[model samples]
Target: MADFVKGLFGGQQPAKVAIPGDDDFADYAGAPEPTPAAISSYTDAAHLAQPTGALTARPYTAWYRVWERTSPEDFKLEMYILPFLFVLILVHVWGTRANRSKAKAWSKAHAPLLQQEFAQVGFREGEATSDDILREKKADEYSTYATGRQNVAFIDFKITLIKRFNPFMLLGEYLIPLFFESIPAPAERVEATAYVFDGNEAKHAPQYGSGDAKKVSNSSFDGFVFAIVHKDIMKRMREDRYDISLTTTRDHAKLPVWTAVMSESAEITDMMLTPELIKAIHDAGDSFEALIVTDQPIDQPKTLDDTKPKKRINLSLKLESTYTATLPLFQLFLRLPDHLATAAHFRPEALRRIKQTRDEQISKIRKLDDDEKAEERKVAADKQKRELRDQKLGRLSAEEQRKFLEKERERDSKKKMKRSTVKG
Candidate 1:
């Protein structure tokens, strides 16, 4: 329309201009279409068959390849097996917990029976009363932990009834030592007797132990007779000191046959019985009998006051029957069967607990002994070193003395370092 308007107004006609790139399109449009064979020749078959970088497997996609490799049969099998395995693990855990609970309950139920067994022996559970005393160094916290701590002492308050003294042994050499051994033996003999049996009965004859045994000894009497008294009465005996002495009578009708001063020892009061005194009593038609006398007078408590004056308890250790006399050796064997019978009834768990407590007590006593021994050794070593130093100083000149002092200081420092290393 613009071109017609321009022609009427005497303007020249506008021509259509062609795009610069349309020449190739006009040529191609006039050309014939290519055949299928020609197109196939231009295409690369290998390039299409081979994987491209974009289509190639990657490290991150390795799991997908693994999934593809798995058989459908294996996947079906796992589906049925996995749940059973999970249930098995749960059952195992539950079974373990149930067993633990059952064991704990059983232990709680039988603990009291085990304690009763301990009482059968001389061990009773209670606080320190007037009857029992604990004479050992202990930590302040120990008292607060348990009342049974006080009753841990080996000695029971009541005197255990020993079998009647054998008339045969009274004439034997063994009787001499019973009184003589009461007086401390020679150092060699005492040391030799440290471990009497070492738990071996066949090699060493059954005899009383000395040094090491004394540390963990729980028996009130030495030799064949080991008497265990009741807990209640033992408590009363510890409240006060009483004189226990052996006396012999010239005649059965005579009064105050034997007389001796009472000397106190570890828990029990003792007096030396001379052979001459024993003979005098035997001549008195008393059959060499020893009478035990205690100054503990018996008195009744009029009031129920806790602050009441202390009363001396009249205690007695009497023979059951003078007629049924047995040798000490035979008496020892007789007690063995009684011990066995008592032990046979104890449950395994209770026995284990008893052994554990006994071991703990032994360990504590042993530790205290070791500490005391160490202190004694240290004191002796210091004295020895001091004496040696004095002798060396007396021989040395001023210059030599100075050097000796320096060397001693170095030696002492090294010794201290060695001790610390050992402790660590």
Candidate 2:
């Protein structure tokens, strides 16, 4: 105890004193004293141990031996990754090829029907190539288009198909519909048609309207057409809301319910919607989405200053079922341009009013363009003046800059006075 206390406080070293059971405790704990041979074996076996002396070169077979001894469980997940990716890629390629085959078959089947109507028919199979995408903005991989006749400016018939083996589509089309009854399953196929014809007398700006067929009680007005014209056109046609002159109640009694008429007078409507056309509408039923006679541009211009687009009559329809029987309806629409030009003759008064409306729209567009240009010029002029003033100030001394600012203020005041005097 005295020696332990002296060791803590005093500088002198104390004599060593071992515990009585220290050797027995070490033996019971099973920790043997390390030997020179045992230490040398441990150092040689450890692959990661640093050399105390010079570094020695290891044989290449040593690395191979270490790799062979590694557990297979270490790389179980990585082994499956490449094979799974290859299978996914193969499925995508098969789906794409199948889609193209279906499109080709559809085009082959429908080519004969188009040939019957057109003198020179051309069929082009749809592709998702970069060139096709660049040529047509709305290019689809699964769609095929046919062009017929020279008079017909454009014809686009698109058939959209479900992407085969697509996981996302499988989830939406099958699994989601099973869980949610209200959510309808996606259609396997959908078809849409657009026909554009060049016309000589279609001078109106963009105008749009839509209507549907409805049954009425009266025999005379069995399929009463409920027409809704564009709001702007409606406003111009009728000055007072209370007035019944432009009302659909009397004007569209003979036409199908929900058929839109864009004309100020009913003369154009009566000329276009003949008995045959009405019969076709009734016959086509719900399959017929619309048979529009529009002169609007298919693609809108970026600027009002762009050259006026050509005038044409456009007919658009969307059908869920096959449109083989609807070929006659297409022919009817094809003949509409000639029917309006030759068969239907408008009154001189009506022609003058229509021309006037077109001229007004042209003038309005021109005014807007001019205003935009004037604003741009004004901004440019202001910027130029600011830059010149800045340059001048940069060249001038502090005192000179002060005098220059004063002179500028005086010139502005004089200009304001001159403008006021002119007004007075």
Candidate 3:
């Protein structure tokens, strides 16, 4: 009892009794030894007691710390990329605003001149409010100019002020200058006007050259203004399909040296360029680019079936200023079609020849179109045949597929044999 009390109070230890065959207990054990306590689920009490500083830390400061640890090359790349993107955005914004301001100013300046010519003078297609102009952000929308319609005989008159600050042109204009100063920067803006009118009675397309006499004569002729006729007409001319040439030389003595004509014949050229008209052209000075009378489409046709294009008289001019001095030239251009109808009429013989040439050209084009359609139909039929064969093969067994292929081969052989016999 004394020993038990001492042990309970933790002052004395109890001795263990020795058992016989203790080493042999493992041999007698039926169950496997219990697994050590799993470390995966274990947690330290000390660690749990420690403070977590994440809640009080600043996010931006943490991010900065991560960036500070980046490699030198990576840091340099980041610096360059960030600044470039910022500059690009700034340039785009500035350019857009500059273009808009210039367009608005031009519209205001030209409003009076346009109002005088037309009953309705407004933005392209129809009238637009200040809000509408501000909202237009696209490059194409900016390119389109102000228009005037509801004139006496004219279809529409347009005045376009080309944008000076173009983001697309920035690379060539600004960056290229740094490397090669010798390369001159092209003109940024062009103030141009176009007067359009129907010329249904025009027998043949006629184009006249403009600008300084020496320059006009010496410069190589290219562009739509020079070639008023269709590609078909040009092609035929190249092939020597006609007896007369398309180029009709003007009388330099009677007309200005700058006035060069490309027409169907001398008769049409003579009729088109009268003394009064020549005087008007001469007065217009170097501002004139071309006076085109064409029956061909200005824009490309959407389909092959759209063969017949409308006839029109197109007068292009470069206006240096918003001054009303060029108003008389505009007036003369407007009355040109009327003048042609009343004062100048083509002889019956000349009209007959022009009509005949046009009809022949149309016939040839139609034939080519019919041939293309035939080829398309043939290709479509072949495609359908292939699809049907594929479907039939997909449904068939392996043996049936082999039999079908053999039959096809036999049919093809028979066709070849029949062709050879016919040729013999």
User: Candidates 1 and 3: which is better by TM-score?
Assistant: 3
lDDT per residue for candidate 1 within 39-106, as digits (tens), equals: 66657887678667757666465566877767778788788889977876676566444433332332
Q: State the lDDT of candidate 2 residue by residue for 1-424, as single tens digits.
A: 9878975676465434556768656544533356675455545545557665536665457567867877878778878897888887887778766665555554554555555555434443432332231122121234434443333434555555555646566556877878975554554443434343333112211211112112211111001111233232244323332221223433356655644454444665676678887777656544454444433233333345432433344343433346654555566765554454454456776456545544565677788789999999999999999998899799999999999999999999999999999999
Clashing pairs in 1: 131-235, 157-234, 158-234, 247-258, 248-257, 248-258, 250-284
Which order, best to worst by lDDT? 3, 2, 1
Instruction: Work out the TM-score per prediction.
Output: 0.21, 0.51, 0.51
lDDT of 2 at 285: 48
Between candidates 1 and 2, the one scoring higher on TM-score is: 2
lDDT, residue 204, model 1: 35
- Alpha-carbon RMSD to native, per candidate: 26.1, 16.6, 13.6
Clashes of each: 7, 9, 0
